[model samples]
Target: MSQTPLQEIELYAFASNSAQFHLTPHEFDVDLGGTVYVSTPIERNELALGAEAAKSALELKLPQTCDLVRHLLANALTGDTTAITLRIARRDPWGDTWWIAGTRWMGRVLGVEVADDGARVRCESAQVSLKRIGLRRLYSRTCSHVLYSAACGASPISASAIVSGSTGRSVDLDGGVPGSVSGGLAGGWLQTPEGARHMIVSETGSGVELLYPATIEPGTEVLLTAGCDHSTATCASRFGNLDNYGGFPAIPSKNPFSTGVF
Candidate 1:
Protein backbone atom coordinates (compact mmCIF):
# COMPACT_ATOMS: atom_id res chain seq x y z
CA MET A 1 0.00 0.00 0.00
CA SER A 2 1.14 3.58 -0.67
CA GLN A 3 1.94 5.82 2.28
CA THR A 4 -0.14 8.82 3.39
CA PRO A 5 1.23 12.37 3.15
CA LEU A 6 2.77 14.22 6.09
CA GLN A 7 0.85 17.05 7.76
CA GLU A 8 3.60 18.89 9.63
CA ILE A 9 7.39 18.86 9.89
CA GLU A 10 10.19 20.59 11.84
CA LEU A 11 13.06 22.41 10.09
CA TYR A 12 16.48 23.48 11.33
CA ALA A 13 19.08 25.69 9.64
CA PHE A 14 22.87 25.88 10.14
CA ALA A 15 24.76 29.02 9.16
CA SER A 16 27.47 28.30 6.62
CA ASN A 17 29.99 31.14 6.17
CA SER A 18 28.00 33.43 8.44
CA ALA A 19 25.04 33.24 6.08
CA GLN A 20 22.18 35.62 6.87
CA PHE A 21 18.68 34.29 6.27
CA HIS A 22 15.08 33.73 7.32
CA LEU A 23 13.09 30.52 7.72
CA THR A 24 9.48 29.45 7.30
CA PRO A 25 7.25 27.91 9.97
CA HIS A 26 8.53 30.46 12.52
CA GLU A 27 9.49 33.12 9.94
CA PHE A 28 12.52 34.27 11.94
CA ASP A 29 15.91 35.27 10.55
CA VAL A 30 19.44 35.45 11.94
CA ASP A 31 22.80 36.90 10.97
CA LEU A 32 25.16 33.92 10.70
CA GLY A 33 28.63 35.58 10.73
CA GLY A 34 28.13 39.19 11.79
CA THR A 35 25.53 41.91 11.51
CA VAL A 36 24.83 42.77 7.86
CA TYR A 37 22.02 44.53 5.96
CA VAL A 38 18.77 42.98 4.85
CA SER A 39 15.05 43.74 4.33
CA THR A 40 12.45 41.74 6.23
CA PRO A 41 8.96 42.07 7.65
CA ILE A 42 8.77 44.31 10.71
CA GLU A 43 7.63 41.52 13.01
CA ARG A 44 10.23 39.05 11.72
CA ASN A 45 12.99 41.63 11.84
CA GLU A 46 12.16 42.42 15.43
CA LEU A 47 12.16 38.79 16.43
CA ALA A 48 15.44 38.12 14.67
CA LEU A 49 17.05 41.23 16.08
CA GLY A 50 15.91 40.25 19.55
CA ALA A 51 17.54 36.84 19.23
CA GLU A 52 20.78 38.33 17.96
CA ALA A 53 20.82 40.94 20.72
CA ALA A 54 20.26 38.29 23.34
CA LYS A 55 23.18 36.25 22.01
CA SER A 56 25.40 39.33 21.89
CA ALA A 57 24.47 40.22 25.44
CA LEU A 58 25.42 36.74 26.59
CA GLU A 59 28.74 37.03 24.80
CA LEU A 60 29.50 40.38 26.50
CA LYS A 61 28.59 39.09 29.95
CA LEU A 62 31.14 36.27 29.82
CA PRO A 63 34.18 36.43 32.15
CA GLN A 64 35.96 39.71 31.50
CA THR A 65 39.36 37.99 31.27
CA CYS A 66 37.99 35.47 28.78
CA ASP A 67 39.02 35.87 25.13
CA LEU A 68 35.63 37.26 24.06
CA VAL A 69 36.31 37.06 20.34
CA ARG A 70 37.50 33.44 20.53
CA HIS A 71 34.58 32.66 22.85
CA LEU A 72 32.14 34.25 20.41
CA LEU A 73 33.62 32.36 17.51
CA ALA A 74 33.46 29.12 19.43
CA ASN A 75 29.84 29.78 20.36
CA ALA A 76 28.94 30.54 16.76
CA LEU A 77 30.50 27.25 15.72
CA THR A 78 28.49 25.49 18.44
CA GLY A 79 25.31 27.18 17.25
CA ASP A 80 26.00 25.98 13.74
CA THR A 81 26.37 22.44 15.05
CA THR A 82 23.05 22.64 16.87
CA ALA A 83 21.31 23.97 13.80
CA ILE A 84 22.61 21.11 11.69
CA THR A 85 21.45 18.49 14.18
CA LEU A 86 17.94 19.88 14.21
CA ARG A 87 17.88 19.86 10.42
CA ILE A 88 18.88 16.21 10.29
CA ALA A 89 16.18 15.26 12.80
CA ARG A 90 13.60 16.47 10.29
CA ARG A 91 14.45 13.87 7.65
CA ASP A 92 11.58 11.72 6.42
CA PRO A 93 11.48 8.82 3.94
CA TRP A 94 11.89 11.11 0.94
CA GLY A 95 14.82 13.31 -0.04
CA ASP A 96 16.05 15.84 2.55
CA THR A 97 17.86 19.18 2.38
CA TRP A 98 20.21 19.54 5.36
CA TRP A 99 23.92 20.07 5.95
CA ILE A 100 25.51 17.84 8.56
CA ALA A 101 28.43 19.59 10.24
CA GLY A 102 29.63 16.79 12.49
CA THR A 103 28.11 13.87 14.42
CA ARG A 104 26.19 16.47 16.44
CA TRP A 105 22.73 17.34 15.19
CA MET A 106 22.17 20.93 14.03
CA GLY A 107 20.82 22.80 11.03
CA ARG A 108 17.13 23.49 10.33
CA VAL A 109 14.85 22.37 7.50
CA LEU A 110 12.95 25.35 6.14
CA GLY A 111 9.80 23.87 4.50
CA VAL A 112 7.84 20.64 4.10
CA GLU A 113 6.92 18.68 1.00
CA VAL A 114 4.48 15.78 0.79
CA ALA A 115 4.46 12.79 -1.52
CA ASP A 116 0.89 13.12 -2.69
CA ASP A 117 -0.55 16.42 -3.87
CA GLY A 118 -2.73 17.27 -0.83
CA ALA A 119 -2.82 14.33 1.53
CA ARG A 120 -2.34 14.74 5.28
CA VAL A 121 -0.41 12.35 7.52
CA ARG A 122 -1.95 9.11 8.65
CA CYS A 123 0.18 7.15 11.09
CA GLU A 124 0.76 3.49 10.28
CA SER A 125 3.07 2.20 13.01
CA ALA A 126 5.02 3.70 15.88
CA GLN A 127 7.29 2.83 18.81
CA VAL A 128 6.31 4.55 22.07
CA SER A 129 8.29 4.81 25.31
CA LEU A 130 7.72 6.63 28.59
CA LYS A 131 9.74 9.79 29.17
CA ARG A 132 11.55 10.68 32.42
CA ILE A 133 10.03 14.15 32.44
CA GLY A 134 6.45 14.31 31.30
CA LEU A 135 5.31 16.48 28.40
CA ARG A 136 5.97 20.21 28.58
CA ARG A 137 3.36 23.00 28.44
CA LEU A 138 4.17 24.22 24.92
CA TYR A 139 4.08 20.72 23.44
CA SER A 140 0.67 20.20 25.00
CA ARG A 141 -0.68 23.42 23.55
CA THR A 142 0.96 23.24 20.12
CA CYS A 143 1.40 19.59 19.19
CA SER A 144 -0.49 16.92 21.09
CA HIS A 145 0.40 14.12 18.68
CA VAL A 146 2.77 13.11 15.86
CA LEU A 147 1.98 11.19 12.67
CA TYR A 148 4.46 9.71 10.21
CA SER A 149 4.57 7.48 7.14
CA ALA A 150 7.07 5.76 4.80
CA ALA A 151 6.60 7.66 1.56
CA CYS A 152 7.12 11.05 3.20
CA GLY A 153 10.94 10.68 3.22
CA ALA A 154 13.44 11.85 5.82
CA SER A 155 12.55 15.52 5.75
CA PRO A 156 9.42 15.80 7.92
CA ILE A 157 7.44 14.56 10.90
CA SER A 158 3.81 15.36 11.59
CA ALA A 159 1.88 17.39 14.18
CA SER A 160 3.45 18.07 17.54
CA ALA A 161 0.86 17.99 20.36
CA ILE A 162 -0.34 21.14 22.03
CA VAL A 163 -1.74 21.62 25.51
CA SER A 164 -5.53 21.85 25.84
CA GLY A 165 -7.22 21.80 29.21
CA SER A 166 -10.36 19.81 29.69
CA THR A 167 -13.62 20.90 31.26
CA GLY A 168 -15.64 18.34 33.25
CA ARG A 169 -14.90 15.64 30.72
CA SER A 170 -14.59 11.86 31.05
CA VAL A 171 -14.68 8.85 28.79
CA ASP A 172 -14.95 5.05 29.00
CA LEU A 173 -12.40 3.43 26.72
CA ASP A 174 -13.19 0.14 24.95
CA GLY A 175 -16.84 0.42 25.93
CA GLY A 176 -16.32 0.98 29.62
CA VAL A 177 -13.54 -1.56 30.06
CA PRO A 178 -11.33 1.45 30.91
CA GLY A 179 -12.66 4.82 32.04
CA SER A 180 -10.73 8.11 31.79
CA VAL A 181 -11.47 11.57 33.11
CA SER A 182 -10.37 14.81 31.44
CA GLY A 183 -10.02 18.27 33.00
CA GLY A 184 -6.35 17.73 33.76
CA LEU A 185 -7.56 16.00 36.90
CA ALA A 186 -6.65 12.47 35.95
CA GLY A 187 -3.26 11.09 36.97
CA GLY A 188 -1.03 8.04 36.61
CA TRP A 189 0.00 5.88 33.68
CA LEU A 190 -2.85 3.77 32.30
CA GLN A 191 -1.91 0.60 30.46
CA THR A 192 -4.31 -1.62 28.55
CA PRO A 193 -4.32 -5.39 28.40
CA GLU A 194 -3.74 -4.98 24.68
CA GLY A 195 -0.38 -3.17 25.35
CA ALA A 196 -1.11 0.51 24.58
CA ARG A 197 0.13 3.05 27.16
CA HIS A 198 -1.37 6.32 28.38
CA MET A 199 -0.02 8.85 30.87
CA ILE A 200 -2.84 10.50 32.76
CA VAL A 201 -2.66 13.80 34.64
CA SER A 202 -5.08 14.73 37.41
CA GLU A 203 -4.04 18.27 38.29
CA THR A 204 -6.91 20.69 37.92
CA GLY A 205 -6.60 23.18 35.00
CA SER A 206 -3.56 21.43 33.47
CA GLY A 207 -3.39 20.25 29.92
CA VAL A 208 -1.94 16.89 28.87
CA GLU A 209 1.54 17.18 27.36
CA LEU A 210 3.24 14.91 24.83
CA LEU A 211 6.96 14.41 24.44
CA TYR A 212 8.75 13.19 21.34
CA PRO A 213 11.26 10.63 22.49
CA ALA A 214 14.90 11.24 21.66
CA THR A 215 14.99 7.78 20.13
CA ILE A 216 12.89 9.12 17.25
CA GLU A 217 16.02 9.93 15.25
CA PRO A 218 16.26 11.62 11.89
CA GLY A 219 15.32 9.60 8.79
CA THR A 220 12.89 7.37 10.65
CA GLU A 221 9.22 7.50 9.62
CA VAL A 222 6.28 6.38 11.73
CA LEU A 223 2.55 7.13 11.67
CA LEU A 224 0.69 8.73 14.60
CA THR A 225 -2.75 7.70 15.85
CA ALA A 226 -4.37 10.38 17.96
CA GLY A 227 -7.34 9.67 20.20
CA CYS A 228 -10.54 11.46 19.19
CA ASP A 229 -10.94 13.21 22.54
CA HIS A 230 -7.77 15.24 21.89
CA SER A 231 -9.30 18.68 22.29
CA THR A 232 -9.55 21.17 25.15
CA ALA A 233 -12.74 22.90 26.13
CA THR A 234 -11.37 26.15 24.73
CA CYS A 235 -10.26 24.54 21.49
CA ALA A 236 -13.60 22.83 21.03
CA SER A 237 -15.46 26.06 21.62
CA ARG A 238 -13.30 27.94 19.13
CA PHE A 239 -13.09 25.17 16.55
CA GLY A 240 -16.13 22.91 16.49
CA ASN A 241 -16.04 19.95 18.85
CA LEU A 242 -13.71 17.27 17.44
CA ASP A 243 -15.42 14.32 19.08
CA ASN A 244 -17.32 11.99 16.78
CA TYR A 245 -19.85 10.14 18.93
CA GLY A 246 -17.92 8.60 21.86
CA GLY A 247 -14.63 8.30 19.94
CA PHE A 248 -11.92 10.87 19.29
CA PRO A 249 -12.28 12.66 15.96
CA ALA A 250 -10.01 11.66 13.11
CA ILE A 251 -7.48 14.28 12.10
CA PRO A 252 -8.06 15.70 8.65
CA SER A 253 -6.39 13.57 5.99
CA LYS A 254 -5.50 16.70 4.04
CA ASN A 255 -2.80 19.30 4.50
CA PRO A 256 -3.85 22.70 5.85
CA PHE A 257 -2.00 24.47 3.02
CA SER A 258 -1.70 23.72 -0.66
CA THR A 259 2.07 24.32 -0.57
CA GLY A 260 2.46 21.47 1.95
CA VAL A 261 3.83 19.19 -0.75
CA PHE A 262 7.06 21.09 -0.68
Candidate 2:
Protein backbone atom coordinates (compact mmCIF):
# COMPACT_ATOMS: atom_id res chain seq x y z
CA MET A 1 0.00 0.00 0.00
CA SER A 2 1.16 3.56 -0.65
CA GLN A 3 2.02 5.57 2.47
CA THR A 4 0.96 9.11 3.23
CA PRO A 5 3.35 11.75 1.94
CA LEU A 6 5.30 13.72 4.58
CA GLN A 7 3.46 12.25 7.54
CA GLU A 8 3.59 14.28 10.71
CA ILE A 9 4.68 11.33 12.85
CA GLU A 10 6.60 11.57 16.11
CA LEU A 11 8.99 8.82 17.09
CA TYR A 12 10.22 8.24 20.62
CA ALA A 13 13.47 6.34 20.50
CA PHE A 14 14.73 4.98 23.80
CA ALA A 15 16.14 1.89 25.55
CA SER A 16 19.70 2.70 24.64
CA ASN A 17 18.39 3.80 21.26
CA SER A 18 17.47 0.19 20.53
CA ALA A 19 13.71 0.50 20.87
CA GLN A 20 11.43 2.85 19.04
CA PHE A 21 7.86 3.83 19.80
CA HIS A 22 6.26 5.39 16.76
CA LEU A 23 3.31 7.60 17.52
CA THR A 24 1.27 10.13 15.62
CA PRO A 25 -1.34 12.57 16.77
CA HIS A 26 -3.22 11.30 13.75
CA GLU A 27 -5.71 8.44 13.94
CA PHE A 28 -3.81 5.90 11.83
CA ASP A 29 -0.59 3.96 12.05
CA VAL A 30 2.03 5.60 9.82
CA ASP A 31 4.90 3.64 8.35
CA LEU A 32 8.22 5.50 8.52
CA GLY A 33 11.69 4.10 8.33
CA GLY A 34 9.94 0.82 7.55
CA THR A 35 8.51 0.74 11.10
CA VAL A 36 4.89 1.20 12.04
CA TYR A 37 3.88 3.66 14.75
CA VAL A 38 0.49 2.55 15.96
CA SER A 39 -2.28 5.02 16.45
CA THR A 40 -2.66 6.39 19.97
CA PRO A 41 -4.15 9.37 21.76
CA ILE A 42 -1.22 11.77 22.21
CA GLU A 43 -1.15 15.34 23.56
CA ARG A 44 2.19 17.10 23.09
CA ASN A 45 2.85 20.70 24.02
CA GLU A 46 4.52 23.14 21.67
CA LEU A 47 8.35 23.11 21.70
CA ALA A 48 9.73 26.60 21.46
CA LEU A 49 11.85 29.17 23.25
CA GLY A 50 10.56 32.35 24.95
CA ALA A 51 8.85 33.47 28.14
CA GLU A 52 5.51 31.80 27.47
CA ALA A 53 6.74 28.30 26.76
CA ALA A 54 7.91 25.28 28.71
CA LYS A 55 11.05 25.52 26.63
CA SER A 56 13.27 23.00 28.35
CA ALA A 57 10.60 20.49 29.22
CA LEU A 58 8.72 18.22 26.82
CA GLU A 59 5.70 16.29 28.00
CA LEU A 60 3.83 13.56 26.14
CA LYS A 61 0.50 12.23 27.30
CA LEU A 62 0.18 8.59 26.34
CA PRO A 63 -2.38 5.97 27.25
CA GLN A 64 -1.55 4.13 30.46
CA THR A 65 -1.98 0.81 28.66
CA CYS A 66 0.60 1.59 26.01
CA ASP A 67 3.77 -0.46 25.62
CA LEU A 68 6.07 2.52 26.27
CA VAL A 69 4.51 3.23 29.64
CA ARG A 70 4.85 -0.38 30.70
CA HIS A 71 8.46 -0.40 29.56
CA LEU A 72 9.25 2.77 31.51
CA LEU A 73 7.56 1.45 34.66
CA ALA A 74 9.52 -1.79 34.49
CA ASN A 75 12.90 -0.11 34.19
CA ALA A 76 12.26 3.16 36.04
CA LEU A 77 12.70 1.98 39.60
CA THR A 78 15.22 -0.76 38.99
CA GLY A 79 17.93 0.64 36.73
CA ASP A 80 19.76 3.88 35.97
CA THR A 81 17.02 5.79 34.18
CA THR A 82 19.43 8.35 32.77
CA ALA A 83 20.71 5.91 30.18
CA ILE A 84 17.18 5.58 28.94
CA THR A 85 16.41 8.66 26.89
CA LEU A 86 13.50 9.83 24.76
CA ARG A 87 14.00 11.49 21.39
CA ILE A 88 11.04 13.27 19.83
CA ALA A 89 11.52 13.36 16.11
CA ARG A 90 9.18 14.18 13.23
CA ARG A 91 9.60 11.96 10.23
CA ASP A 92 8.50 11.79 6.61
CA PRO A 93 8.66 9.22 3.84
CA TRP A 94 11.80 10.04 1.80
CA GLY A 95 11.02 8.33 -1.47
CA ASP A 96 12.39 4.81 -0.79
CA THR A 97 12.87 5.08 3.00
CA TRP A 98 11.77 7.38 5.78
CA TRP A 99 13.92 10.12 7.24
CA ILE A 100 13.88 12.14 10.42
CA ALA A 101 12.62 15.36 8.95
CA GLY A 102 12.96 17.34 12.13
CA THR A 103 13.59 16.92 15.83
CA ARG A 104 11.43 19.00 18.12
CA TRP A 105 12.88 17.76 21.38
CA MET A 106 15.67 15.39 22.43
CA GLY A 107 16.87 14.69 25.93
CA ARG A 108 16.99 12.34 28.91
CA VAL A 109 13.80 10.97 30.43
CA LEU A 110 13.31 12.93 33.64
CA GLY A 111 10.31 11.04 35.04
CA VAL A 112 6.83 9.65 34.43
CA GLU A 113 3.62 10.56 36.16
CA VAL A 114 0.69 8.17 35.89
CA ALA A 115 -2.93 9.12 36.13
CA ASP A 116 -6.25 7.42 35.51
CA ASP A 117 -6.35 8.89 32.03
CA GLY A 118 -2.79 8.43 30.81
CA ALA A 119 0.90 8.45 31.63
CA ARG A 120 2.89 11.65 31.21
CA VAL A 121 6.47 11.26 30.08
CA ARG A 122 8.61 14.25 31.00
CA CYS A 123 11.95 14.96 29.40
CA GLU A 124 14.49 17.73 29.88
CA SER A 125 16.19 19.31 26.92
CA ALA A 126 19.73 18.04 26.34
CA GLN A 127 20.98 21.62 26.39
CA VAL A 128 19.47 22.29 29.81
CA SER A 129 22.06 20.03 31.38
CA LEU A 130 24.91 21.95 29.81
CA LYS A 131 23.46 25.24 31.05
CA ARG A 132 23.44 24.05 34.67
CA ILE A 133 27.08 22.97 34.68
CA GLY A 134 29.74 25.23 36.10
CA LEU A 135 33.25 25.87 34.87
CA ARG A 136 34.82 23.69 37.54
CA ARG A 137 33.87 20.56 39.41
CA LEU A 138 32.31 20.79 42.86
CA TYR A 139 33.71 19.46 46.12
CA SER A 140 32.44 16.10 47.24
CA ARG A 141 33.56 13.00 49.08
CA THR A 142 33.33 10.60 46.15
CA CYS A 143 34.58 10.36 42.60
CA SER A 144 32.32 12.07 40.11
CA HIS A 145 33.20 9.89 37.16
CA VAL A 146 30.99 7.05 36.07
CA LEU A 147 32.24 3.50 36.36
CA TYR A 148 33.97 1.99 33.32
CA SER A 149 33.51 5.24 31.39
CA ALA A 150 36.09 7.12 29.40
CA ALA A 151 36.58 9.77 32.12
CA CYS A 152 37.01 6.97 34.62
CA GLY A 153 40.03 6.26 32.40
CA ALA A 154 40.30 2.95 30.61
CA SER A 155 39.80 1.35 34.01
CA PRO A 156 37.99 -1.92 33.51
CA ILE A 157 35.71 -3.65 35.94
CA SER A 158 36.30 -7.18 37.19
CA ALA A 159 36.81 -10.05 34.78
CA SER A 160 34.06 -11.82 32.93
CA ALA A 161 32.29 -14.64 34.75
CA ILE A 162 30.14 -17.48 33.57
CA VAL A 163 26.57 -17.25 34.74
CA SER A 164 26.17 -19.81 37.50
CA GLY A 165 22.46 -19.13 37.83
CA SER A 166 19.76 -16.72 36.76
CA THR A 167 16.50 -15.23 37.95
CA GLY A 168 13.80 -12.91 36.73
CA ARG A 169 15.77 -9.85 37.88
CA SER A 170 19.03 -11.15 39.25
CA VAL A 171 22.03 -13.29 38.48
CA ASP A 172 24.10 -15.73 40.49
CA LEU A 173 27.73 -14.78 40.21
CA ASP A 174 30.36 -17.42 39.71
CA GLY A 175 31.76 -16.56 43.12
CA GLY A 176 30.60 -14.85 46.28
CA VAL A 177 28.59 -11.74 45.61
CA PRO A 178 29.66 -8.68 47.49
CA GLY A 179 27.14 -6.08 48.45
CA SER A 180 27.37 -2.49 47.14
CA VAL A 181 27.88 -1.13 50.63
CA SER A 182 30.85 -3.42 50.93
CA GLY A 183 32.37 -2.07 47.70
CA GLY A 184 31.46 -5.14 45.72
CA LEU A 185 29.48 -5.72 42.55
CA ALA A 186 26.39 -4.11 43.98
CA GLY A 187 26.95 -0.62 42.54
CA GLY A 188 28.69 -1.94 39.44
CA TRP A 189 27.17 -3.49 36.31
CA LEU A 190 27.11 -6.53 34.10
CA GLN A 191 27.24 -6.49 30.30
CA THR A 192 26.65 -9.14 27.66
CA PRO A 193 28.25 -9.42 24.27
CA GLU A 194 24.92 -8.51 22.73
CA GLY A 195 25.14 -5.10 24.47
CA ALA A 196 22.62 -5.76 27.24
CA ARG A 197 23.68 -4.08 30.49
CA HIS A 198 22.13 -4.33 33.92
CA MET A 199 23.32 -2.37 36.92
CA ILE A 200 23.68 -4.21 40.19
CA VAL A 201 21.56 -2.74 42.93
CA SER A 202 22.63 -5.01 45.76
CA GLU A 203 24.48 -8.27 46.02
CA THR A 204 24.73 -11.15 48.45
CA GLY A 205 26.16 -14.61 48.62
CA SER A 206 23.09 -15.73 46.74
CA GLY A 207 23.22 -13.50 43.66
CA VAL A 208 23.37 -9.96 42.37
CA GLU A 209 20.20 -7.92 42.13
CA LEU A 210 19.95 -6.16 38.77
CA LEU A 211 18.01 -3.08 37.84
CA TYR A 212 16.17 -4.52 34.82
CA PRO A 213 13.73 -7.45 34.80
CA ALA A 214 15.40 -9.57 32.14
CA THR A 215 17.23 -12.73 33.16
CA ILE A 216 20.42 -14.26 31.85
CA GLU A 217 20.79 -17.88 30.96
CA PRO A 218 22.96 -20.02 33.21
CA GLY A 219 25.53 -20.57 30.51
CA THR A 220 25.69 -17.01 29.26
CA GLU A 221 28.93 -15.18 29.82
CA VAL A 222 28.71 -11.83 31.55
CA LEU A 223 31.17 -9.19 32.68
CA LEU A 224 30.98 -7.91 36.24
CA THR A 225 32.40 -4.55 37.35
CA ALA A 226 33.26 -3.50 40.85
CA GLY A 227 31.27 -0.74 42.52
CA CYS A 228 32.70 2.40 44.03
CA ASP A 229 31.30 4.15 47.07
CA HIS A 230 33.07 7.27 45.72
CA SER A 231 34.83 7.73 49.04
CA THR A 232 38.51 8.68 49.18
CA ALA A 233 39.25 5.47 51.01
CA THR A 234 37.61 3.38 48.31
CA CYS A 235 39.59 5.27 45.72
CA ALA A 236 42.93 4.62 47.43
CA SER A 237 42.23 1.07 48.47
CA ARG A 238 39.98 -0.49 45.86
CA PHE A 239 40.88 1.04 42.52
CA GLY A 240 44.15 2.67 43.62
CA ASN A 241 43.31 5.69 41.50
CA LEU A 242 42.84 8.35 44.13
CA ASP A 243 44.57 10.90 41.94
CA ASN A 244 41.68 10.72 39.55
CA TYR A 245 38.99 11.16 42.19
CA GLY A 246 36.64 13.99 41.21
CA GLY A 247 35.41 15.16 44.60
CA PHE A 248 37.36 17.34 46.99
CA PRO A 249 37.03 15.25 50.15
CA ALA A 250 39.37 17.49 52.05
CA ILE A 251 37.05 20.48 51.87
CA PRO A 252 36.18 21.70 55.36
CA SER A 253 32.71 20.84 56.50
CA LYS A 254 32.12 24.33 57.89
CA ASN A 255 32.50 27.12 55.40
CA PRO A 256 34.52 29.78 57.20
CA PHE A 257 33.77 32.27 54.44
CA SER A 258 30.09 32.11 55.26
CA THR A 259 30.48 31.88 59.04
CA GLY A 260 33.12 34.69 59.25
CA VAL A 261 34.62 32.74 62.19
CA PHE A 262 37.53 30.73 60.90
Among all candidates shown, the one with the greatest lDDT: 2
**Candidate 1 to native Cα RMSD, angstroms:** 23.0
lDDT per residue, candidate 2, 96-139, as tens digits? Answer: 44456645555767676666577888877666756776763445
Quantify all predictions' global Cα lDDT against the true fold.
Answer: 0.26, 0.63
- TM-score against native, each model: 0.17, 0.61
| Residue range with the least summed lDDT across 10 consecutive positions in model 1 | 119-128
Query: CA RMSD for every model?
Result: 23.0, 7.2
Off by over 4 Å in 2: 1-9, 13-29, 33-54, 58-104, 108-122, 126-133, 136-139, 174-183, 256-262
- Displacement of residue 142 (Cα, Å) in model 2 is 2.1
Alpha carbon lDDT at 10, candidate 1 = 29
Clash count, one per candidate: 53, 1
